[model samples]
Target: MEKDFKEYITPPVMLVVLLLAISLIFVFPVLNMIILGAILAYGIRPIARIIQSKLKFESISIILAMIAVLVPLILLIAYIVSVVSGVLTDFLASNPNFDINAVLTQASVYVPQLSPDNISTTIGDIAKYVANYLVGKIGSIANISLDLFILICSVFYFVKDGDKCYNFIKSFVPDDHIEFFDKTVESVENVLKSIFYGHFLTSVIIGIFGAIGYTLLGYPYGIFLGVITGILQLIPIFGPWPIYWALAINDAFNGNYPRVAVVLLFGFFLSWVDMYIRPAISSHHADIHPLILLVGFLAGPLVYGIVGFIVGPLILGITYVVLDSFRKELTESK
Candidate 1:
């Protein structure tokens, strides 16, 4: 009886528990990176495979597919850096000699009984403290560089041996729930594809209009601001609003009313794109509940910073899909 019980656990239950404990231990470092890497690989693999199938050259296909993914990212970063530098130079050149205290005093008009003097002093103090605190912060750039290097190493390994690693890891799941496990994976993939594709297309469309409008109006950082505004459009609600408002406020402070007016008009048009165009396009890929997506979006930054933006939603979507699958499976089995 004792031997039979031991053998029973050995066949599956013991293996399951052991794997679960290991997964829990390295969940963040290894599993998280692997999952992210797999999703990235999955997204591009089809294109690579298509090329290989047509040309019978797997190596060339892989190289082309990698270039397609990597080159745009490098260019995008370079563009951002260049634009930011230009904007900073432009801002410094424009000498706006306005009293910050006076602006605060004027703002207290609608909300009477507030002391503008105290408010101005407090604002000035906080601003000084913030500047000092930022100066005191050390080695953030170095830390970021190190993290990027680590991520690149992980990504390379993942792309190379991802399938074998995934299979080995996934093997721990009980045979009974294997189908459910597969469903969870598909759900995650679907969510990622939906988010990436929807955001990319929408941003491109917005960038086209934004750039054209900014260029015609002769905004100093037209191309830069346009691209930044379009990228920011990925965020919900107050997405493009920040860039538009920043440009407007910067122009206002510089006494450039014409520039402000042009940017404001551009902002209004962009809102229409965000409110109407995105939902229509995204629905075709995935019928995500706006509320759920909104919650995930807010939670994403809190939990995992930038990576969490996509990872959070993917996690939620997979959980929801897996639970649904389990329930359906149980019902049919019953």
Candidate 2:
């Protein structure tokens, strides 16, 4: 009886230890990587598959596909990083002796209804009161570098092992449900592909028009601003309007009165394109309501950051299809 008790206890204890070891060694990192890699893979998997089918070369196809996809992304990220870094560096170099109180006092007096007589004295007093209010910039170079490295590594692993992943997931589904699951996943994949491709094409159109309009209007950094505006336009709801409006306001502030009208007109055109064109494109691609797509866009970012834009909508689409299928089945049976 003592031997039997010892044997059972040892097995249970060993099992617990093994489970703990597996959790520490395997579960945590994989879970984190899955979230990261799945998003990257979802975006690029179509292109990779196309390359495989058309090019008929496995390793070369994937490599070329990665280069085609990642090179522009890397370049874009570098450009943004450079621009942000330059801004930060300029700020650091300026080392401004900010007189916050004086500015506030002057600002208050400049307002339409404020007293003029109290302006200088108020400004001086406020300046003296808030002399120590200052902030220093923290450089983001290290963090950006680390993030880029992780993203690249994750993308590589994701592309390499994606098939294995599909098989692993497929293994879990019951035999009868397998086809349904496959079809659902395919539908989700198609939705994601459509959204991405449509958005990309629309952005290109907007970016080109923006570049031309801004350049014609003689705005500084028009091309850069246009590209930025175009990308921002991909965001749901708020979209590109804010950026163009901000640019227009900057022009007004800087006394470029003539260009302000042109800028405003440009923004309006872009907004029009977004309103009219995007919905049509989305409809063509997804066969879903534009309103629902908009909701997906809004919810996607909230749920999954950049990736959520595609993933969230795909999820909603799949669920809609599945529920509709069930509803049809029930009606038929009845």
Candidate 3:
């Protein structure tokens, strides 16, 4: 009985327990940042490797890759923020009084139960709620910064030592199970890459076209609305329709019937781009069901906030692969 109990506390078992504990500790606090870093590392690893091969230095390669990736992302974010700020400033300037009642009255035409008389109090309540929310978030700024720093450092290390990390993980699995594990990892990687490439590329294409269309039509904040439309493309089944339709409604209200028609036509075209582009890019790599991706995007943010968008789909994909693998194993056993 004593010998059996000692054997039960084997090295593998102990290591697994330690790993589980470490993962549990990180999951709630910094798992999202770590995951994001891992994803970035995976995406940029090829570039990093190529640079490493030429430069003969892993650190130099990682630094270059980080610069190459981060600089554009930073610029894009800055541009979007500036554009959005400009649009808000213009809106406030144009509507100097910024009457909540007038906006409510317009909306009440569609939502018949909306009382224009109560709009002022409703607006005040909403403003107070938003202010309180912002105040609450202010307390988390330091934590957010720390997470961001961790994320950056993790990405660098992951990119530099990803293969070693992968090997270390592989060491834990039995030799017989290693092949299956590798397949699962490969499948997950393909799914993630496909999702990133297909969705991002499609969004960019639609946004650029929408921006050009809006500019030609002399719409205010053409670039800003276009950028928003691009982000909205992340949501399945309702990509950019709300924004375009709202613009169309505004045009209709202004009696610009021709511009409304043009907006509708362009909007329809932009929406169709997803149907063509997403399948072409994503389906080639992984046969992920559209429904799975939809659920991941919709439920992910709900559960994990912003990080859920990526994490949600990933979890679902991994779950799918695991189930499928087990099914295969069962089938083979029979």
Alpha carbon lDDT of each predicted model: 0.73, 0.71, 0.85
User: Per-residue CA lDDT of candidate 2, range 38-78, in tens?
Assistant: 66666666678789898887666667777888799899878
Report the C-alpha lDDT of model 1 over 1-334, residue by residue, as the tens digit.
9999777876477888898898888665444455565566666677777877888876677667767888998998998998788776776678466555576667778555445777767789999999886775553666555555655555555555668887996997899878878877766666676677666678878877787777887776678777887777767665678878888998999999988988898888888887787788777766677777777777977977677666677777666656776788789899
What's the CA RMSD for each of the models? 5.2, 8.7, 3.3
Which residue pairs clash within candidate 1? none
lDDT of model 1 at position 136? 58
Identify the leading candidate in terms of TM-score. 3
**Ten-residue stretch with the least lDDT total in model 1:** 28-37
TM-score result, candidate 1: 0.71
Question: Where does the lowest 10-residue lDDT sum fall in candidate 2?
Answer: 132-141
The deviation in Å at residue 139 for candidate 3 is 1.9
Error of 1 at 105 (Å): 10
